[model samples]
Target: MDDDSDVSGLRATLRANPAGHWLSTPAPQVAEQLAQTDADFVVVDTEHAPTDLESVEAAVRAVDAANATGEDGAADTAAVVRVAWNDHVRIKRVLDTGAAGVMAPQVNTVDEAEAFVAAARYPPEGHRGVAGTRASRYGRDLDDYYERANDRVATIAQVETAEAVDNAGEISAVDGLDALLVGPADLSAALGVFGEYEHEQFVAAVEAVLDASTVPVGTLATSLDEVDYWAALGFDYQIVGVDAGYLRTGAAAALERYEQVGEE
Candidate 1:
């Protein structure tokens, strides 16, 4: 895609809409396939999944290709990558792959959030070193990418710890930090109430993060059933399905169907 091409789908959609859903996966092909779906964005999970930079780059290219030729074909679907941590080198590498954004995990403090934003941005804003990566169209769009990247590229910080919840307001207020996401399972564990979403402390912690956040915030729902509850609570985005979840559910259902037919 050209530097002038509308590569800001995820950012623009988040701005215009109240909430959006994203598909998270570790597989590049699946990432490409889902980008063609109604999902607004696809996030390649590099932290938990055994995904390397090469795989992440492939996924980003897949999203770019899928968006290039879909029905409405505005290439509006975005591809975001969730890095393993809030490190400068990792963040810069992924951003160079032309992703719409990078989601940094375990940002439990304002300083960590600032560091993430700095690494994702360029000079004057931060210290991100520029290279002729695919993001710059191999030096062809170097000038344009340099000028517009800092504004267009998103920097999402994950608020998955009790400490982060306490500092949510400050983190959200940091310049260049685009969004905040509460990692439910991790936060629950951090609160000493693992797997108990309805526990008072778990609920309260989630609410605290929600109340403290000043910018767009998001979280991962265990299932589609929980989406409305989260949306009502003011989450700007929700991740409902992971690639593993989809495969597991589908495989289980198919086996159950086969068993039922045999019993009949």
Candidate 2:
């Protein structure tokens, strides 16, 4: 990555298109394929996926390769890794993989949000230990990377609990936080209305976060309909699809079609 080529573009893209959509996948090949599309970013999910640091690094490289091979010679797609937790070790390791950003899950307070951002930043801003990692081109671009990493790295906090909803404003106000994402499945489950997005309590919690957030707010949308639904409800951005879900749906449809043809 070049000096000016950090996640700044990703941040700018989201700012320009509040309803910008992203895709999440655990596979590097899948991430590369998705990154080649118009999606603003592709998330390599470590939170719920069986992905490790090595996989995250490979996925980030794949996304970068996709951008390098774009038809126009400039692909806007960036790689954002969803770290398994708010721990600094995980956040630092993922960022070192050259991911454009890191999304920390279950951040429910200002302190947690700050910690999340700090882990992605270098000294003076945070305590992220510097190294000649892939992010710095193995010591070749260390100086430039260190100088720009703090500003270039985008930090996102996932609001999944009632406490997060109540503290959304404070969390959003954290200096280095780029965005807030509502983990709908977890948030709903926390509110005793699992999968019931239409439930009053669930709606209220989402609305609370939406209303309190000072930065761009987003959520995960599993289907096309939910895209419009969340957009209408004022979500700033969304992860529109999941790789596993797509595979299952596509395979099922293909089998159903084949069964119908055999019956005919």
Candidate 3:
């Protein structure tokens, strides 16, 4: 499939069934493995992870490779990079890596949201620099990529602060801003109730975002229960699991099993 179609299909999938997973380890192999799963999309998390630009590119390639093989015959999984911040350079470079979308952090105002969208889109809509990068098959598909990028590339702004929640309605209404993701950890901390997902203040803040957003809203869930909780609360989509979380859980489980066998 062409790059544009990949992103277009991703938008459709998210609208129809908003389920995704996260990669925090920055390993291309891990990304490939995850991409081969039945996930609707996979987020390569650079915001909190140690993923550099090169690593991000490799991971994007791995995801593409895995999607091409369809080893398990699962549907194609789009790769979305959650950049470290809402910076123009970072946004442009990562998009060059052929990511299906970008999820920027801490977009707290309408202006910030607009800037985020502008940086991700090309001219006529915004100011993303044109390039013959991997996104365009190194100039082979440049014209086509440029033509469809503004419409196809997903631009997601993270609502992680009290101010952002306050501006959610305006931010969501920004043209070319495709979605809003709640940065639960940062948002809770910003609300002065760190890790208190159930605290009244935090709950109220989240509800405010839900109520205000005109675009699809989503959040990250570290476990199946959290998945159920967020889905129950009506989040349009969710990044359901993190790679580090999986490593920690799986390792702990194996160690516990080993100790049990030794005891027996």
Candidate 4:
């Protein structure tokens, strides 16, 4: 929140900001280390990890530290959480942990997307219950929190299935939905042409989402070539793999070179 990088307004930044994500291992050090990278944001993935409430809290704190300490306490980066699903309990928990946004996964239809917003948003506008959480600063400023949260916390719908692709337009029509986030891997799997998103059909699906989204679309691209590709295609937000990739790549290359030298 201190960053002026309104999680809710990330779509606006995508016009100029090149946001990215790194998968952290539910460890504060991991998140902190990843935060030190050049990415605009760090997405805390709780979907595949055994991240409990406490770990999520610590990860946020670490990211905040990484973001805050960098430039005279100016907010350099943001901490977001990808809740396991679009469930209320998980959504509330992540928000309580001070996540600037929630990435709801496996969205297959418009109704599911609507439900996600409803569960994440606070009353009248949404069914989300008011709570004394860290995100709201423990009810210390409930009114201020409510007034800002409705506009501050972002909602990202992960388009992961074939059905989601078919209903992209309807899903994108939902108000308060920040970005139409696509999970290309799951999409490939569901298409029955696993890992073949480069195929014509998959590419068409991507185009359909792009054509339909009222807001800017977000995705995870694999390489610099891919980043250039997406940028040309008008994708506003993207994650260019992880910090681990760079580290592991260099480490493996170094190990191989060392082995060759020793053998020589």
Candidate 5:
């Protein structure tokens, strides 16, 4: 409801060059801190993180607050929710909480992609349940919100299987689908090469999705080192680091420094 920020820019950014972090830590404060980063957007990974709707809503609020006065100009960081599943009930809950986007994992076919999009949208476009939730300013921004929801809310379908890669084009072409994300680990496993990032078959499957996608494509870089690799491959977006990964890496470095001091 904060009209001052004009977050519609996120829609364009996701379709263009989205680069950001993944909030694997299920905390609202973490979302607030990361939203202030130079990243273009951040996705709260509810699929893997033990995040409930309350924390997810809090995180979404934090993101909006951070973006309100963020120095990134029109490139403000957007908050996306990676819901636990593609179920309409769960997707509707997240949308009602005001997340800028919703990402569903393991979307392996055109029907799955369509279902994801439908859940993210309201009537006329889809059958999402309406409510006077935060997204509509608790009824204050009703008319405007309803009119803009379909256009403003982004829908991302993650392609994480061999089947998804094969049907990437059809999935991407779904009417309301905005983007396709590749789940590298799951995808590689399905291709019979778990963790083999450079295996020929795994690489081919990734390329297959990339080549077939009609929308912006994204994948996890797993580390800061691989950011450019994925980006250079023509990926529209890339998640360079996750909250848990950052925490572990920082903690390990600190312990190493302490050990060096003890040796000295």
Candidate 6:
């Protein structure tokens, strides 16, 4: 959530790898330029942004446009939305926009995780009420949408609390979950040790998450050194840095390292 570091296309590209250019950017042509750089998927972060219904809809349109240029048979850089929270209504509305998945935030228990999955799916597989909207190709095909929801749509729960770490196994074991995303700042706060993911206790908690998780587990790692280490430890995916983080860090480094003829 650092500044504008949305997770929309990024999440999808990570899951739908090796299928053309899955990378996409947020609103405006900037996103398309970014998508051109290429990736496996993209994600739009609505949870932290002031993204209202209108804006979310616009973002999806932009991402889809970028995906169109990737190549024939391009995976289309599945759109994903990280809703503001685990609210079912919000989940349904965003999914209605045609996002390929949802990333539920602050899930601290198995029940919360289950509730998230249920909200993301429809009957038999879940409790999400059926609604023929833009997500199902604008209602052109109802049965196909129902049949494929469980398969094509993904749900990733964010494990950012100490209690969530404690119940990682149970939460991850939920049938429809595709992955567990660790939110560092929240997790650090929950553990009573802010900004120190490498601390022994924090590390232990993370290891527990990975060990107990039945699906892919990931977190943000800023530096190349840290990225290599975590990946070596079994994290297959990570955000090098969120968009806002990259901007601020750049500004700070430029000012700090700039050589003003007389200043050392």
Which has the better TM-score: candidate 2, or candidate 6? 2
Q: Compared to the true structure, candidate 4 yields what TM-score?
A: 0.87
Q: Model 5, 1-264: lDDT tens per residue?
A: 113233255666676676888998777889888988867788988888889999899988887777755364443778889999889999999888888889999898888888888888789989998889998889898888888777777888898899999999999888878888898889988888998887889888888888988788999987766786777667888888888888899999999999999999
The count of residue-pair clashes in candidate 5 stands at 0
3 against 5, candidate with superior TM-score? 3
Q: Which ten residues in a row have the lowest lDDT in candidate 4?
A: 1-10
Q: Which one is best on lDDT?
A: 3
Instruction: Estimate TM-scores for all models.
Output: 0.90, 0.90, 0.92, 0.87, 0.91, 0.81
> How many clashing residue pairs appear in each of the predictions shown?
0, 1, 0, 0, 0, 12
Q: Tell me the whole-model lDDT of each prediction, alpha carbons only.
A: 0.79, 0.81, 0.86, 0.76, 0.83, 0.70
Worst 10 residues of 2 by lDDT: 1-10
Q: Write the per-residue lDDT of candidate 1 for residues 186-211, one digit (tens) a residue.
A: 88899899878779998888788878
RMSD of each: 4.0, 3.6, 3.6, 3.7, 3.9, 6.4
Model 5 spans with C-alpha error above 4 angstroms: 1-7, 69-75, 261-264
Residue ranges of candidate 6 with Cα displaced over 4 Å: 1-30, 68-76, 223-225, 249-264
Across 2-114, the per-residue lDDT of candidate 4 in tens digits comes to 22354444434444545777564778988887777756778888887778889999988887778744343224667778888889888988888877778899987878888
Task: Estimate, for each residue in 1-264, the C-alpha lDDT of model 3 and write its tens digit.
Answer: 123244454554555557888999999999998888867788998888999999999999988888753464323788899999999999999999999889999999989998999999899889999999999999999998898777677888999999999999999999878789998899999988998888889888888888988778999999888898888877889999998888899999999999999999
Error of 1 at 59 (Å): 0.7
lDDT, candidate 1, residue 79? 78
Q: Indicate the TM-score of model 6.
A: 0.81
Summarize candidate 6's per-residue lDDT along 1-264 as a digit string, tens digits.
111122223343444322212122345454344444554445567776656776666766666776654443434555567888999999999888877778888998888988998998898868887878877778887777777676667787888988999998998888767778888778988899998867888888888898888677877665657667677767646655454554568798888777663495
